[model samples]
Target: MAERKAALNRAPARPELKERLERAKTIVLTEEQMQEQRASFAYGNAPRNSRITKASATSATKRIRLSDPQPVT
Candidate 1:
């Protein structure tokens, strides 16, 4: 109980994820930017047989699609 109380008292000065997101939440899309991003995400550029359902995680190691930024397939 004493350790738990100390941990709570020394808890973060602010919510950590919220603090990180505050700096990183600047991805608002202009219409042109939205169109460009959508256009870039498909066709032969994407990985073949590349998808991640919940089951894929359990079977074995998975391939990382480093070729695609924010890899979509």
Candidate 2:
């Protein structure tokens, strides 16, 4: 219990580490800002003209070897 208490009360060693921690805590976005960020991410995944084809998707998956040496009996 004493060890845990000491660990909890200790401050970050570096000034930059303390500053980063404070910055992270104070980063509060408004609803409009959050919506804009979400929209940017959604569009970033694919351009306006990009399309996914069945062949492209299926090619990404693993395939079983039809000519296996030890075939299932």
Candidate 3:
């Protein structure tokens, strides 16, 4: 408890941090910006060659059957 109290007291709270937090909470994104953000989340930072496509995903699902043993590459 003494160590925890000392750790908590080590950093003094700043009013600027509180103001920044409040300012951050009020931020609003435009529709275009929201669409860009959604696209970013959907297609993250992966290289184009390694990314999965809808057709490829469906074909892969069709290739792997529950009854058949998965082929070892």
Candidate 4:
């Protein structure tokens, strides 16, 4: 009995698109204004960082002092 080789039906690879997708996973922004947003996604989709941590957000959250009535001297 003769053994026949299986044919590989491979498609042409698009390296450029692959590179673009890889780059999208780690979008870098140099502007300070967008630091927070960048940090939020720095880990690619995982919710694990200062920006994603619940304690960091709630503990560091600022409360409005205006909520209290001003003391009239």
Candidate 5:
């Protein structure tokens, strides 16, 4: 379409976008920094009971049944 052709021709003026990409590429993490981040967020340190299985959800219902009181004989 005519609009698509116009947009493609206008794409070369975005120098700020190219600069942002260069800045992002400068933020690479070293091996030691990556290891420290992994150690800090290890699975063993996650909160307990964070996952709920189907069995756990169904088993948590009250064992007793609710009913009205019987009248005196």
Candidate 6:
């Protein structure tokens, strides 16, 4: 439609994003830092004492079961 074409021709939502990305600095993490980052994401923001290990994470999910489906009217 003509409206769709006009919308596509408009400027991007973030016109300065390209320049901002070009000016941004890149970080290089050491091996140990990378491992820590991975662990943080895997375990989320859980407390240290309650955080589950990777093995436990899989096992915990395995215990979950979906409820029986209800028939539609």
Off by over 4 Å in 5: 7-12, 30-73
The residue ranges of model 6 lying beyond 4 angstroms of the native Cα positions read 1-24, 45-51, 54-73
Q: When superposed on Cα atoms, how far off is each prediction in RMSD?
A: 13.3, 19.6, 15.3, 17.0, 24.5, 15.8
- Which of the two candidates, 4 or 5, achieves a greater lDDT against the reference? 5
Task: Give candidate 1's error at residue 3 in angstroms.
Answer: 37
**Candidate 6 accuracy as lDDT:** 0.57
Of the two candidates 5 and 6, the one with more favorable TM-score, higher being better, is: 6
Q: For residue 55, give model 5's deviation from the true position in Å.
A: 18
Best by lDDT: 6
Which lDDT tens digits does candidate 3 get at residues 1-73? 8768777755778899999888867666554444455455545544688766544454444443344323333
List model 5 lDDT by residue over 1-73, tens digit each: 8868776764557789989877866675554544455445543454677664444433332232324433223
TM-score of each: 0.28, 0.36, 0.37, 0.24, 0.28, 0.31
TM-score of 6: 0.31
Scanning candidate 2 in windows of ten residues, the lowest lDDT window is: 64-73
Local distance difference test, candidate 1: 0.47
**In candidate 6, where is summed lDDT lowest over 10 consecutive residues?**
64-73
Q: For model 1, what is the error of residue 31's alpha carbon versus the real structure, in angstroms, after optimal superposition?
A: 0.8
Candidate 1, 5-57: lDDT as tens digits: 77676556678888777765654545444444444544325466767433443
Worst 10 residues of 5 by lDDT: 57-66
Q: How many residue pairs clash in each candidate?
A: 0, 0, 0, 0, 0, 0
The Cα RMSD of model 2 versus the native structure comes to 19.6
The better-scoring model by TM-score among 1 and 3 is 3
Candidate 2: Cα lDDT at 59: 35
Cα error, candidate 3, residue 44 (Å): 2.2
Cα lDDT, all candidates: 0.47, 0.52, 0.56, 0.47, 0.52, 0.57
